[model samples]
Target: MQTILIIEDEKDLAELVAFNLEREGFRVMTAHDGLTGLDQASRIKPDLVILDLMLPGLLGTEVCKTMKRNEKTAAIPVLMLTAKGEEIDKVVGFEVGAEDYVVKPFSTRELILRVRALLRRAATPPSPGSVVKVGPLTLDVERHSVAIDGAEVSFTSTEFKLLHILVQRQGRLQSREVLLRDVWGYAFVEDSRTVDTHITRLRGKMGAAGELIRTVRGFGYKIEL
Candidate 1:
C-alpha cells in the first residue's frame, strides 16, 4: 500500500482526489495548506506527493524545493497540480524538482494515470549489471546510482529514466516522441517540449558531464562520449 500525500487548499477537491485514489488502492493523506502539507510530508515521508501550485502559507514550488533539498524526503516523487496551463509554469514546476505536472480542470482518469506512472517509475530499478559509462559519468543500473567524476549525483526518477535511455543507446538519435512514450509512458506525443525541459534540468544536474548528451537539430537528443 503506497502512501500518497495530497496538498491542496480546497478541501472539497482534496477529498475528492483522496476518495478516488483510495478506491485505486492507495493510502491517502491530505493537508489543506502549504505549510501544513510541507510539515506533514517531512514527518510522514509518503511515497508520492500530489501538491497544488498555490497554497496558503507556502507555494508548491517552495515546498518542492525544500523537499528536494532535504536528504530524507528528496527521493520521494512529486506530482505538481496547477491551474495554469502555461508552458512556463510547467517548466518551472519541473525545474523545481517536480517529477510530473497536472493542469487543473483535469479529468480524474488522467490524474490517476499520471500518479500510477510516476509511482511505477519510482519503484522500478535498473536491470542487473547493466552499468553504463560515458566520459567521467558512471551509471550503476543495478543500484540505481549515478556518479560523475567519482562523485554521486542525485536525479529524480524521471531524470534517471531519461538519462538511462540516452546512455544505454549512446550516439543513437532518440526522437522526442519516442522518449515521451518510453520514458514518460505518454501514449501520444503531446507536450513534446516537456522532453526538452527535462533534458535541460537533467543536464544542469549532471554539471560538466551534461555535455555527453547531445541534441540533434529538429529531432531529439542523444548521449555520446
Candidate 2:
C-alpha cells in the first residue's frame, strides 16, 4: 500500500482525513507539528505529504523547502493544505516545491482525488526518449537530472517535468491550460497563476539558460533554442 503522511494540527480533521485515506486503501500517518512531520517524512519517506501551512513549530513552506533540498526526499510530492485562498499564498506554496494546493473547507472527495493524481504522476515512467537536449540545457529523463552548460542544477520533480515537456516540444507554444493538464494532471484548470509561478522559479534555477523558456505574453510559455 502507498504511504501518505498528513501534517495537520487539527486533531479531529487529521483523524478524519486519515480514516478516509485508509478506506481508500492507503497507509496514512499523521503529525501535528511541522518539525515532527519533517522528521517523520525523512525517516519513513512517505510517497506523498499533505502539509498544513500553519503549524506550531515551523511553517509549512520551510518544511517543504528543506525537503526539496534533501536528495532523499526531494522527489516526493507535496500537497499544501490550508485555509488561505489568496493568490500570494498559492504562489508561495508552489515556490516552496508544493506540487498541488488545496484550500480549507475542501471536499474530502476532491482531496482524495488530488492525492491519487499526485501519486499517479509520481509513479509515471520517463518517456521512451530518455535524454533530451536543447541548446545549453540537457535533461536525463531516466536519472531525473538536468544540467545547464555542463553544470548540474537542482529542480523539484514538478519543475523537472514542466521543463522536460517544454524542451521536448522545443518551439511549440504550450498554453497554461494544456500545461496544467499535462504536467500537473489536473482535470480542470482552476488557476493559471500556478503555471506562471512555476515558470518564474524554473527560470531562476536555470540561470542563463533560463532565457530559453520564453513567455508568449497573454498565452503561455515555450522553449526556444
Candidate 3:
C-alpha cells in the first residue's frame, strides 16, 4: 500500500479525506498541525503529501520547503490546497517544490485523481525526450532543473513541465484548458487559474527568460521569441 500523508488542520475534513483514501486502498497518515506534519513527513517518508496552505505552527509553504530540502523527504511529492485568490502563496508553494495545486472547495474526486496522478508520475521513469529549451532557459526534464544562460535556475517538476510544454510550442497560444490537460496531465475539470498561478511563478524564476512566455488576453500563455 502506498502511504499518503495528509497534513490538514480541519478535524472533520481531514477525517473525511482519510476515510475516502482508506476506502481507495491507500494507507493514510494524518497530521493536524504543521510542526507535527513536518516531523511525521521526515520520519515516515510517505509516497505523497496532501498539504493545506493554512496550517498552524509552520504553514504549508514552509513544510514543503523543509521536506524538499531534506534528503530523507526530498523525493516525496506534495499537492498543495489553497483558497481562491491566494494565488500568491500557490506560486510560492510551487516555488518551494510542490508538484501540484488544488483550489479550496475542490471536489474530493478531483483531489484524489490529482494525488494518484502525481504518485504515478513520480513512479514513472523520465523519458529521455522530456527536456526542453527556449531562448536562455534550458529545462532538464529528467533532473527537473531549469537553467538560464547556463546558470541553473531551480524549479519544481510542475514548473519544469509547464514551461516545457510552452517552449515546445513557442509562438503559438495555448488555452488554459489545454495547458491543464497537457502539463497537469488532467482534463478540463481543474480551475483554470491553476495555470495562471504556475505561470506567474515560472516567469518569476525565469527572470529575463520569462519574456519568452507571454500571456494571451482572454486565452492562455505562449512562449515567443
Could you tell me every candidate's TM-score relative to the true structure? 0.86, 0.88, 0.88
Candidate 1 ranges beyond 4 A from true positions? 129-131, 142-154, 205-211
Candidate 2 lDDT, 1-225, residue by residue in tens: 999999999999999999999999999999999999999999999999999999999999999999998989988999999999888898889878899999999989989988998999999988875878898999998888999989999887888899999988999999999998889887556667788888988999999899999999988999997
Give me the displacement of residue 116 in model 1, in angstroms.
Answer: 0.6
**Against the true structure, candidate 1 has what lDDT?**
0.89
lDDT of 3 by residue, 1-225 (tens): 999999999978889989999999999999999999999999999999999988999999899999988989988999987674476666677778998888788888988888888888788765575667777877776676778999998767777678877877889899999998877667654478888888888778888888888888898889988
| lDDT for residue 210 in candidate 1, whole number 0-100 | 90
TM-score of 3: 0.88
Candidate ranking (TM-score, best to worst):
2, 3, 1
lDDT of 1 by residue, 61-165 (tens): 999999999998998999998798798898789878898888888899989988988888778766667777888999988787899999999887678888989
| Candidate 3: pairs in clash | none
* Candidate 2: regions farther than 4 A off: none
